[model samples]
Structure formats: structure tokens, C-alpha cells
Target: MKSNRMVLVFFILILTLWGCEEEKANKEVKTHGAYTENNVAQKMDKEDKNNEKTAKNQDDNNSVQYFIEEEDFQKFAKKGLNPFGQEKKQINLSSTDFEYYIHGMTHQKVKAKEKWDFFEMHPKRIKWLLEGLEKTKYKLGPDKQKYREILKRWKQKDFSTIVEDHNFIWDENEGTVGKATDRLSQEDEREYLESEYEMMHHFK
Candidate 1:
């Protein structure tokens, strides 16, 4: 009877060991599968993020919408492009606008190839151009008759139907208007960036 009892105990011990081995093997297989799946998911997520960023940058590079409203341009011209008015009789311009304008237009008069090249490499550089337009200081009597002539040219140059090369240049008008354009300036862009930057800091 004692010998039979010992045999029964041994059988139970063998069964327990087998059960443990099976459990361990199952755990290892499940763990490895889960790890592979996670790796693949992470790679796909990163790829998607990169694609989104690229799309956003492309949009920003071409953000400018061309052509000021013809009526608005005329209104600005009628205002004599001068902030100080005719009574003040003195022209004051910020250094930022004056320096940038000549350099920006220098492409037209001196280096057409270089100007075109600049736009090809970095289109966003022209984002600051509208601002420069707002920065121009109006001198009295640029050419009243000439201003009229340029206005005619601007009206004639509208390319509502055409595509490509729809450039809007300063009308060669001698209006005593305080400014050539009512465009947003670099200062304005800077201010907006700063405001947005400050607003975003808290999220980080």
C-alpha cells in the first residue's frame, strides 16, 4: 500500500511541471507577437506625421493671394498715399520699408535672372513683400498726371481670366497719396507671430 501511494505522488508532480512549461511557452509567444505589432504601428504613425508636416509647409509657402481689389487700390491712391497729409508737407519713412523695397525691386531693374531665382528657391520670401508695400512713405506730388496714367495701366492689367505672371506692380502714378499700398507690414507679421508664439507656450 505504501509503494502505491508514492507512485501516485510522483504522477501528480510530473503533471504540475508540464502544466507550468506550457504556460511559460504561451506567454513568450504572445509577448513576441505583441512587440512586433507595436513596432509596426509606431512606424506607420511616424510616417503619417511626416506626411502631414510636409503638406502644411507646402501650404504656407504659397500662402499669398495675389491682386489687391482694384477699387481699394484706387481708394488708397486717392488718399494720396500719404499718412501725414498735404498740410504736413514732410515725408517720413521707416528704414525697414525703404531698404527692403529698393532691394526687392532691384530684381526688376538690375537683376531679373537673380530675382526669378530667389522666388524659385524660397517663395515664402515674398510673403514679406505685401508688408513692404504698406511701409512706403508718401512724398507729396509723385506725379498727379502720371498717377492717373498708372491707374489706367493697373485697371487695364487685370488678369481675372489669365493664369501665370499676373504681377501687380506699383502704378507709375504721381499721386500725393501717403502710401503706395495698404499692405500689411513686416511689423504686423512680427506682431502676429509673437502673439501666436506666446499663446502656444502654455500648451507645451
Candidate 2:
């Protein structure tokens, strides 16, 4: 009987140890699973934040920045309208700067096709410049007067009238100067006229 009791005790102890080991293994599995899930969640959160930041940066890069100074504006206003080159170096300028270069700088004869491209690329800037010319006050001068009349026609979107006046200027006729405005009545028109007009007589 004593021997039987000893065997029974030993069997119970083995069972208890096996149960404890199994419980410990279960706990370890749960901890590993939870750790994996937490790591995956953290990784997803980090990716989302990175994507948001990238999108914000892209938006900032897409924004447009154009700057124009008074000296540049005056230089352009005096130069009258001229042809702008079709090179990327020219086109890469901001819309406002592009206008200054086209109207302010002198260039060799520009093809009608190139002018058309400029128009197509910067219609808004051109319109804004034309409108500004109509409203801004200028010093007393004939050149200023002629430019005012040209701006008037341009504001009306009358390309034909501009061409006609340009022709008159080409013919060296004083009559091309429209009715004198309060501004620029005292200054000579010679200063405003382009020294070298290279545009074709008419756009195609």
C-alpha cells in the first residue's frame, strides 16, 4: 500500500509540472503575437504620416511665385512691345517676368507662330498687364500717350486697331497718337515708340 501511494504522488507531480510548462508556453505565444501586431500598427501609422508630409510638400512645390520690380516695369513700358524667343530659357520665366522680357527687351524679327505661342502660354498675364496700363497714371509724354491709346484698344481686345495704329506709327504719322489724355500730354511720343519693331505687319 505504501509503495502504491508513492507511485500515485509521483504521477500527480509530473502532471502538475506538465500543466505549468504548457501554461508558460501559452503566455509566451500570446506575448509574441501582441508584439507583432503592435509593430505592424506602428509601421502603418508611420507610413501614413510620411505620406501626408510628402503630399503637403508636393502642394507647396506646385504653388506659383512671380515677382516684378518697378525698374523692370518702367524698362518694359518704355521698350514697347517686342518679340519673345521660343527657347525654354525664355519660357521658364514667371508669367510677369515673361511679359517684361517680351515688351521691355528688343529682339530680332519674331515669327507670328512664336507670338501665338506666347499668347497661348500667358494670356492671363498679358491681359493683366494691358488692364494695368489702362488704369495707371503716367508722366506727361507723347510716347506715354501712344501707349495709352494702344492699351485702350488692347483692353477692348481689338487686335485689328492695334495693328492699324502700329502701321500708323510705322508710317511716322503724328496722327496715330489718339486724343491726348490728362497724363503724358507734355512728353514726346518718340520715347514710347519701339526703336526696332520686328513683328510682322499683321498676325496670321
Candidate 3:
């Protein structure tokens, strides 16, 4: 019986030693594989930051910046704004500017078939345009020798060529420019002025 008791105690001690060795083995285990979660998250964060930076750079690239002085910028803004061209304000501008602006306004208004609905629905803009032309005549052109000689004796209101009964007078009732306002577009103005090239000979 004593021998059997000793054998049972020995078996208990072996089991205790085996449990301690297993615990130590578990503690000593070192992982040898790659770091998966943290490394992946860090790489994704870097990629996200790079993508954000690239998008920001692209947005900056899309902006156009022109370097110019304030006066030049303002002047450039005004370039091509006036479609009438410098011929309208030129020193030696011909009579065509006055006649063309007068008639061109009619061309713009006559297309508006429904706004006024007058006898034939003529636009009031045409009349406003004619009045503007008459007002602009007071604005002087280039003081060239030919212009000076012509205006010396012929005032804008009295010239037969400019104020003739069939052109200058605005007959809204008749839808016409009377005698002085007969000259039409650039082409018509050129041809009509050529008809009076003999009158211009005296100025020469």
C-alpha cells in the first residue's frame, strides 16, 4: 500500500511540472509572419493622403492666372466691346457711319414682328436709333483738310446732301428718313456718296 501511495504522488508531481512547461512554452512563442492589420491601415492612410494631395494639386492646376497691370487689365476688358469699330469715332470718318447706324437700327427692329404691333408693327427702336444718329452728328470727327473744307460753308443741318427732303427728315408716319436719310448700308452709302463725287471735287 505504501508503494502504491508513493507512485500516485509521483504521478501528481509530473502533471504539475508538465503544466508549468506548457505555460512557459506558450509565453515564449514569437510570431514570425508579417504584420497584417496595422501595416495595411498605414499603407492605405498614405495612399489616401497622396490621393488627396493629388486632387488638390489638380484643382490648383485648373485655375488660370494671368499677370497684368491694373490699367492694362481694365483696358483689355474693354477691347472689342464696342462693335461699332473705330471707324465710328475716327477723325476722318465718312458720312457712312451716320447713315449706317441710322438704317441698321431699322434692320434690328423690323425683325421684332410682335413687340409694337403698329400699322405694320414697326419697332420704336428704329426711331430711337435715328434720333441717336442725329445726336451723334454733333460729335466732331477728325479735323482733316477735306472735312474742314466741306463743313466750312455746309452746316450739318443745312447741307443738301445730308438734309435733303427725301433723307434726313424722319417720317414715322411714312416709315422713312425723308430725303437726307436715304443712304442705307455700307454698300448703299458708298454708291450714293459716289453719285456726289462731283460735289466733293469742289472741296478738293
Q: Highest TM-score among the candidates is held by which one?
A: 2
User: What does the lDDT come to for candidate 3?
Assistant: 0.39
On the 0 to 100 scale, the lDDT of residue 10 in model 2 is: 99
Alpha-carbon lDDT, every model? 0.39, 0.42, 0.39
- In candidate 1, stretches whose alpha carbon ends up further than 4 angstroms from where it belongs are 57-204
Estimate TM-scores for all models. Answer: 0.30, 0.32, 0.20
TM-score of model 3 vs. true structure:
0.20
Q: Candidate order by TM-score, highest to lowest?
A: 2, 1, 3
Give the C-alpha miss distance for residue 190 in model 3, angstroms. 49
Q: Which candidate do you rate higher for TM-score, 2 or 3? A: 2
Residue range 105-187, candidate 1, lDDT tens digits? 22211212212211111122232332333443754243333323322332343212111111222222222322222222334
lDDT of 3 by residue, 55-137 (tens): 75455334412122345434534773222322243333335443444333233112222211111101232233333434543
lDDT at 121, model 2:
14
Count of clashing pairs, candidate 1: 14
